[model samples]
Target chain A: MMEVSPTLPAWVAIVTSILVLLGAALTLIGTIGLVRLNNFYSRVHPPTLGTTLGIGCVLLASMLYFSVVKQRLVVHEVLIAIFVTITTPVTLMLLVSAALRRDWAIGDPSVPVPPGLPEEAERPEPLPESDQPTS
Target chain B: MSVLTRRVLPYPLLSAFLLIMWLLLNQSLSAGHLILGSIIGVAGGLAISSLQIPSGQVRNLHLLVQFAFIVLYDIIRSNIAVTRIVLTPGRVAKSGFLYVKLDIRNEYALAILACVVTSTPGTVWVNFDSAKGELLLHVLDLVDEDEWTDLIKNRYERLLKEIFE
Candidate 1:
């Protein structure tokens, strides 16, 4: 495997190493939290650290290393950062909404059903007789 | 600008952003790249203009910058806080759901606030009720309910109101 040359400036190497280490360590903590946290709701909070700052630090390191090596700005890493920043919330929102829907369906007391609707009424109505017969 | 061009390029800011993004992605500032990026940006902007999105005006640019720095600082601080929470074994942080009543009525601003809150490590925006202007947030380390409410209102929502309302 190719390695970063030892001849590079000390600051560049130090910054890159620090960023990479911090990012990796944060990501590890996030994954561990996923397992250690007692419930799904609480578990949702930790992985976001990995997604937000974990990837952010790694991207920063890559940008700095490549820019120093090539002697030109390497900011395309920003595109990924921007994309992740926008999309992660979207996916998280969808996942949380789906989880909420499931919990509501199962009549989980902790999960609040939307106001003015009973738990059973919130569930999808059964298919028509013809559709049900086919299934 | 002509009426036709104004209609086509309804989102001039978006077009400019796309053009800059294209140049950055290509990593080139040559004339050829500039021309191509401009064309693509204008086309993309025109395409999106068909969607008829309601434009939200940003009232204060200085406040927006301050808001960005505040978010950055909060993100770093929360990253450390959450990392500690995760590392310390068998220590259960007092996590709970809290409902916050928001004064900001602009949808675009509310969406941005949600993204910022959810992206921060310790808080997740679980659900928002538009009817009541209330947001449900799941906080990992819920020490004081009033503290969370005050933080959200004063730190973020106030800045967002200045920016988007």
Candidate 2:
């Protein structure tokens, strides 16, 4: 069994472990912000931490580990990095825009009425202050 | 010869990008993979005609690399900053939406800026009113609105304008 698997150097293993743990800790903290933050807009901020640096660290560690194991540069992680960086923003933008539309339709005061569609913003009579998302 | 190939490969950069992507995904540099990647590149580049993707002319490739480094550094710094914001004992980070007018009109530049803003830890891209050229940014650690506006306009906008417009 030992012969089948290539032996990893102590330093590489240590660095990879540290990077993996750090990435995990960052992602966990980011998600914690999602649950912990009082407002939805604020909640959106934390998860991005997970998507950006969290995946970044983990991919870097994996690239290093596999590159060492293969005795060559293993950089397929670049693809994942590109995809994540591009897609996260696209998805986040869509989600935020959709949420904003819904809030505006419902006359949620927490979100400022959008400037682009003044008609839609004016259409909904402002809701009572009795209910608001956690600010 | 140049004109003929240009007709076949209308988007040379896209072709190269697709080829590189194929090579990276397969993790190989063999002859078979090279030929296959070329095929994919050609097909993909031609296929893009089906979609109406307005191509923006890139001005300075060198500045693009430098801009990428700046973004990377910012991302790392913001990661630490956000970590602090989340881990701090009792106080919640002061978060709010901010509105700033932009001068960049190129759609490609706008898209890139949006990605950068949203990907950064503390700031999220909420909305952009193209008609008004206004950006609605949700900042987690909202302190001074002017500071954020300057950061976007000067740090990113100046460089992006150089690159895209």
Candidate 3:
């Protein structure tokens, strides 16, 4: 058995423990929110809470631990953070858009597309007017 | 040269990110690492150029910095609050989804917001309606739907609009 160093900074261990616990707790809350929300759109908020801050804390703890132990700036974990930050919204957006399209196509009462907003907003803008005029 | 620059090194920020990631993962700053990383980054950028992802230009540096700091602080606070709820067990409020009407039309901005929401511990980004501009999110804590909407709109969306839109 490897001997544990008593000289290890107490704050690091303490902070790590707290962050892990926090991450776990936030995950639970997100799950709870999923169960409690009244509607499909309403239910979507909580899970994000867990995924964002939960993962953020856990990553922070990992970064802190590795950096302290290795005595180097170990930030490779930021890649995960960045990737998560970029992808989660995209997945959610796609899913939401799909759901909305389904609702609109079916003329579902619960989901209503606002009257003022144009469908064109949903798609990328057309090529510049200058280029089109030339054609 | 034009072809290489236009396709391969189209997005400077993205290439820079790739290079940084390569260096970080490899944990080296040697000449070999820099050269290899730069090659990969430029190549990767070229590969992505065809996808035609709408290029977003960020204008406000101050707002972005503020946004980052705010998110950091919120994460810390939420972590504490959420951990307490999880440990308590029996007292958890029922969870459910919220439909939020959004004023934000920018795909890139909305995407960033979704990531922010999903990565947080107590929330999940379930779906969004592009045509309707509605965001469907699942919450672990179902205390108030309006509150969540307000939080997203005020806390994150506002800054995103300022920075990206």
Predicted model with the maximum DockQ: 2
Model 1 chain B: worst 10 consecutive residues (lDDT sum): B49-58
Model 1, A25-66: lDDT tens per residue?
Answer: 999999999988887778888999888889999999999999
Fnat per predicted structure, each in turn: 0.73, 0.85, 0.51
* lDDT at B42, model 2: 87
Q: What is the TM-score of chain B in candidate 1?
A: 0.94
Off by over 4 Å in 2: A1-6, A119-121, A125-135
Flag regions of model 3 displaced more than 4 Å: A5-62, A84-135, B1-8
Candidate 3: tens digits of C-alpha lDDT, residues B64-113: 88887887787666656555554464664456567888888888788678
Report the C-alpha displacement of residue B134, candidate 3, in angstroms.
Answer: 2.5
Assess the local accuracy of residue A12 in candidate 1 as a C-alpha lDDT between 0 and 100. Answer: 92
Clashing pairs in 1: none
TM-score of each model, paired residue for residue: 0.91, 0.92, 0.68
Error of 2 at B140 (Å): 0.8
How high is the CA lDDT of each candidate model?
0.85, 0.87, 0.72
Point to the candidate with the largest lDDT. 2
* Model 2 per-residue lDDT tens digits across residues A67-107: 99899999999999999998998898888878777677777
